[model samples]
Target: MEIVTRADRPDLRETAAAVFKERWPEFVFHDEVPRRYTDRAEKYFGLFDIMVLDHGSVVAGGWGVPVPWNGAVGDLPSGYDAALVRAVEAREADIPATTLSFMAAAVGESHDKRGLATVVLQELTRRARDQGLAHVIAPLRPTWKHRYPTVPMDEYAGWTRPDGLSIDPWIRTHQRMGARVLGTAPRSMVIEGTVAEWESWTEMVFPVTGEYVIPGALNLVRIDVEQDHGVYVEENLWVQHR
Candidate 1:
């Protein structure tokens, strides 16, 4: 397998999209912030987007954007949405980037457990270092948090195994590569929709006004039947690589 940037192989964009569709949940595509800025980021920072291709087939991929950062943990962007916005605004404002904020990484379903995700991350980090960025950070969405939707992010991020590794598989993966948790972004990605839209996304019924646990959601979605609205605020843990 070989890793290539979007700048190197623009034709691979469609292939990468297929991989992402298979990796993320249906509702994830409906996040308004990402839906608005993703194309612009891709247009401006194509060099930072990468794909792992196995004999011309996309097996894994990751993407991030450069942004100015203060080098203080407390000053990090609120979460994924904030990071994307900063990156775009910095570009438009002609500010030099000081850090690379990794946004998303995924391995195709057929290629799971082969370490391709690690390869994609390593490549992104290497690119950041090559660009002379000071650090690489991520708004990490814990892989197992969806199973415990009611738990607070700060509490969930603190869970560790007997070996001193994070109990969440995705967090453990980053920790294995020398990343330390910085903090939690309680309102990382806020997704809102009407009751019908929520049902369409999750294929589950929400007949009452209450917090309901749904599949593939990291937090309970609050539904208001009387108002015909539903909202889901996902929390993410911030981590930085040394």
Candidate 2:
């Protein structure tokens, strides 16, 4: 498969959206808040920030945004929400972007084990380097974290395999690609909605006020039945590439 940007083919918006929907179900509930900024980013940067395919089906995609950075260690935004907020601010203020922040990367189900994720990262970094950006950072939502939603992010991030690599395959991929884990973004992305909304999204019943492991949630969702609200705060790892 070949990677193509929106600049190359402006009519692939629906194709890109379909890929996102397939890979990220949670986005259905929480993307509205950040969609405005991401849409603006696409407008300003063209499809340069979006990675799709041409001539063949898109088996992988990467999404990112350019943001102003101070070139200091530990200065990246905490997570996806904060990172996107900064990106929006920079764009609105006409501040030149100094770094590229990768928000999401995914390989189609049938394309797994083909190393498409590595290819996506290489393309993103090459794009950033071509644009004269200093580095690329990611708020990585580990692929396997959803399996153990009750584990604290700090503990999960610290997990290591027998070979001394990350237990999470996704994090291990970043590490192998030369990214260093800075820390955990405890409140990377927050989704809050009514009980009815959560029920519809997860297709599960929340009868009382407490944290429940809803389907597809990266972390337990806190449901306040009396208040008719549910909140999900996802955790992610802050990885930096130099």
Candidate 3:
């Protein structure tokens, strides 16, 4: 299998979109009006490098990640995007230079085992390093990711890491790709522990969040979402060392 990384390639990137479509079906947004991560990725990924390959007869594969700080953490409305830009402008020093916020990489199932995911990630790290991006970061909500129903849009931004292994594998994946765990700050929902502990805590604590709801809006909605009802998603925030 051959791997190639790039800054931008419209033709190849267009083909790569097919993989993303499978991973992030349009139905996700069609079923839910707000259109989740894939929506954002499709809308904006054109601005970044699109890594992919056309592997002969089998299936084509590719993945895309943003430059620096382009991640739409959760429910990134225009205002939130604007605010984040402003914040970056205001505190350049506080946020590390190599902080690279990532979006999801769209890959095809047929292309599995070809090391396509690993290749794309390696390419992304190289490109990020070239651009002086210190780390590749991905921030996703545990609610949408951990099979929890969507957190109220209003409070969604404030929702921290919900406890569990919802995102640990991803971080470990990044570490495998050559990044360090600078820190794991507690978000409103996340917890730190072993796999067994994660399972137990998820069962025990997920329901409790409902009490904090405001009663009328989204917060009031039951977060005790049936695991089967929603799809499971995890955010992978990574920082690849130069």
**Which ten contiguous residues of candidate 1 have the minimum total lDDT?**
20-29
Per lDDT, the best of the predicted structures is 1
Candidate 1 structure quality by residue, lDDT tens digits, 53-138: 89988899999999999989878988999999999989999999999999999999999989888898899999899999999999
lDDT of 3 by residue, 90-192 (tens): 3444443434444445457776666566666666656666766655654322224323334333343334346522243444455456654322222222112
Candidate lDDT (C-alpha), each:
0.91, 0.80, 0.39
Ranking by TM-score: 1, 2, 3
- Model 2 spans with C-alpha error above 4 angstroms: 52-55, 72-74
Clashes of 2: 0
Clashing pairs in 1: none
Quality of model 1 by C-alpha lDDT: 0.91
Q: Give per-residue CA lDDT, model 2, range 97-124, as digits (tens).
A: 9988888887777778988889888888
CA lDDT for candidate 2: 0.80
Error of 3 at 30 (Å): 6.1
